[model samples]
Target: MKLRKINKQVWLTEVELDGYNVRGAVICGDKKVVVLDTLSHPRDMETLSTLIQGRALIIVYTHADWDHIWGTGGLIWEDARIIAHTACLERFNTDVPVTLHEKQLVEPARWNGVQLVPPNETFQDEFCLDLGSLTLRFYHLPGHTQDSIVVFLEQYGILFMGDTVETPFPCLEKQSPLFRWITRLQRWESDPGVKTVIPAHGDMGGRKIIQRNIAYLQDLSAGKDPGVFEPMTQFYRETHGANLGFALNASKSDAFKLDASKKNNP
Candidate 1:
């Protein structure tokens, strides 16, 4: 685990999970310290707890994916408030526990200490948190998952875009609202305020990253192969294949729902 500084207020921590880099972030504020995502396990949070001692702690789960929300134990001291989207909290009763059980069966020791912690606060559309020096504006962005969201810190011009946009491409699933996701990304792209873009997975950069992801999703919707001449690591190559399957599944689901709606209305 390594902690790198993004700015004076923000620090990023990352860990290697199956040849891929998964990241989390910490923002130190005058009134509170906000943890973006908890990474994979309790131990991943170990390296960051000391830097944010004493102040009121607030943990935000970008979503309930296993890689993003399993480390709450490391920073749960003073009645810390865990926050997420309403759909994110709903996932706790569903996929969250099932994912933990499946992983524990494979690596009992590695995941032995992990405990699932659901968010204490949730929002339907938008929410905001004030950190004294800066404020975090949260909006539900449902491209990656229904529970997925993006946080904008206006003071620093940083947008914490969970898994909604990733490098190379964003992953799609049957539940992924493909078109809705692209539209939301477009809104951020046109905004002059979004200077720094922080994603939970892959390389971090400016607004160009958002533009590239938008282009990939558009090509994907057209059924064009997103093949690049440059060499890709084995992990991304495999992920790209999986993404294709998921996109196809989502498209079918959308069509089926549309047909059902038309039949009922007619």
Candidate 2:
């Protein structure tokens, strides 16, 4: 893992594991050091631990996806507090173990010291913590996953969007409300404080990424294809197809119908 300092207090690291390029972040505040999602393996976090040694550590998982939380066991700090959205605990207990078992079948040696470590602190809608000079605000953003959360660094004007916003297009989770997702993206885009947006998988950008995502979602919601707007690699092409499928399926559901009714009536 190579660490690149984004600013004096913020650092970013990208790790390539098993063909997946995962990015993690570190924020060294006045009172505490925050570790933003851990990478794919216990071994991947070894360098991160060395960098933030001898500080009050707080680990925040963007979501309970296996690639993000697999390094939890590697963190040796006894005082470290793991935080995530409330639904992440359920994913850790159910989805994580199943994923681990399935992956172990293919490559057992890579996951040697990994263990299931669920978040000790969780919230439903939002959670804020003051790190003296900086404040971390976590908001529940459901487009990527039900447990997905984005962290906003109040002092730096940076928003860590997790998988809520990605390059080319955003991925969709089952039952994700199209209107709510687009509304949230628009909210972040319009925020004056949010000067930079960082997604979990891709290159970081400004508010334009959020606007692009909104356009794609809007197009899909209106029964139009968004593929012509942006060029996608083979990987994102498949992802786009899946996202379209999810949006189409979600639009027909009762939840979306009710949301549409409320919007139209209001």
lDDT of each: 0.84, 0.83
Off by over 4 Å in 2: 17-20, 228-231, 261-266
lDDT by residue (tens digit), candidate 1, 42-145? 88898776878778889999988999998887666449888999999999999999999999999999898998889999999899898988899999888778
User: What range of 10 consecutive residues in model 2 has the weakest lDDT sum?
Assistant: 257-266
Over all chains combined, what TM-score does candidate 2 have? 0.93
lDDT of 2 by residue, 90-202 (tens): 89768889999988887888765688888889999899988888889999977678898899997889999988888767878777777777777788999989989998886
Return the TM-score for each candidate structure: 0.93, 0.93
TM-score of 1: 0.93
- Total backbone collisions, model 1: 0
